[model samples]
Target: MTRIRISSGSRFEEEIGYSRAVIDGDHVWVSGTTGYDYAAMTIAEDVVAQARQTFENIAAALAQAGCSLDDVVRVLFIVPRREDWEPCWPVVKQYLGNARPASTLIHAGLQTDAMRIEIEVTARRPA
Candidate 1:
């Protein structure tokens, strides 16, 4: 099987030496993505807004990998503040409710304070 790499043009990816997502055979692994709008390099202050943007970022990466959020089989969410998690539930359900991927949430520090949330996902391309 051939491997393919997809980039979101985020400086962090180049600086950190990682692709936004990688495709191996029919599987796609998206990197931990934040809410920063790659084109504008800005993040919203609210956790809910950040959650929405984070999913958009993940969707873009998935699109590049020839898949969609519906193809996601697993998801991981990281929030620096435990309190911020529940506030993002509606946004999470809006995006992944249909896919209903196996999911996990972790409370931990992120690379930046402005980044209230980070999300990562694993998906399989449709057969």
Candidate 2:
């Protein structure tokens, strides 16, 4: 088995000393990802919009790991405000309903106030 590190080019990864995701054997573990559009470095104010962007970021990372959202087996969601969680349901379903991965949601402050949602996931590449 070989270990591989994937990067999203987010400055935080370099500054914080972490890879966006790591591929160890058949598993892909993505770091807690925020909604910032890495290219533009901007995040939407709406939690729903942020949720969508967060999934996109995760999808990109998964893609780099030779998998997709459908390959995800576990997911964790973190939101600063509990109320914001329900509003993001539709976006979550839209992106991850197929995989229906085991999931957990936690209410906690993020690295930045502007980040309404942060998502992390674990996936396995198809055998």
Candidate 3:
């Protein structure tokens, strides 16, 4: 099996010596994605908006690997505060819809205050 690396223009991958996502056969593992919209290079201050953007970013990485949110098998969320999780959950549910993956939420001290969310997801394409 060959390892395929994906980079979604995030500096973390190259600077930190990591790929945005890595594909090993049928599975794609996305790195922890933040709410920073790289197009604008700015983070959203709103928790809900950040959650939506985080999923969008993850979906972009998956799409590049020929996968979609419906293919996701697991999801992880890191938020600065627990209250933020409440607002984020609804927005995330909207994006994932009926394809509920095994999910986990953690309260964290993020690298930036503007970044209210960090998300990671795993997706698998049928063999």
Candidate 4:
């Protein structure tokens, strides 16, 4: 099988030597993605907006890997503050609720205070 690496043009990917997502055969693994709008390089203060942007970013990466949110089999969410999770739930449900992927939420510190959420996902292309 050949390995394909997808880049979101984030400076950190090059600095950290990591691809945003990698595809090997039918599987796709998207790296932990933050809420930063790569084009504007800014994140929203509100968690809801951040959550929306986060999914948008993930969708783009998945598209590059020839998949979509519906193809995801698992999802992981990281939040610096537990309280912020509920506020972001609506957006989360809007995207992944129907797919109902195996999901996990972790309360942990992120790289910055402004960064409230980060999400990572694993997907498989149907054979």
Give the per-residue lDDT of model 2 (tens digit) for 1-127: 8899999999999999999999999999999999999999999999999999999999999999999999999999999999999999999999999999999999999998998999999999998
lDDT digits (tens) for residues 19-125 of candidate 1: 99999999999999999999999999999999999999999999998889999999999999999999999999999998999999999999989999999999999
Candidate 1 C-alpha RMSD relative to the actual structure:
0.6
Q: Which one wins by lDDT: 2 or 3?
A: 2
The TM-score, computed over Cα atoms with residue i paired to residue i, of candidate 1 is 0.98
Give Cα distance to truth, residue 74, candidate 4, Å: 0.5
Residue pairs with backbone overlap in model 1: none
Q: lDDT per model, in order?
A: 0.95, 0.95, 0.87, 0.93
Model 3 — which ten-residue stretch has the worst lDDT? Answer: 89-98
- The local lDDT score (0 to 100) that residue 68 gets in candidate 1 is 96
Model 1 scores worst on lDDT over the 10 consecutive residues at 63-72
Clashes of each: 0, 0, 0, 0
Question: Tens-digit lDDT track for model 4 on 1-127?
Answer: 8999999999999998999999999999999999999998999999889999999999999999888999999999999888999999889989998689999999999989999999999999767
Q: What is candidate 3's lDDT per residue for 1-127, written digit by digit as tens?
A: 7999999887777788999899999999999998888888888778888888888999899999998999999988898888888867678878787679999988888888888889999999756
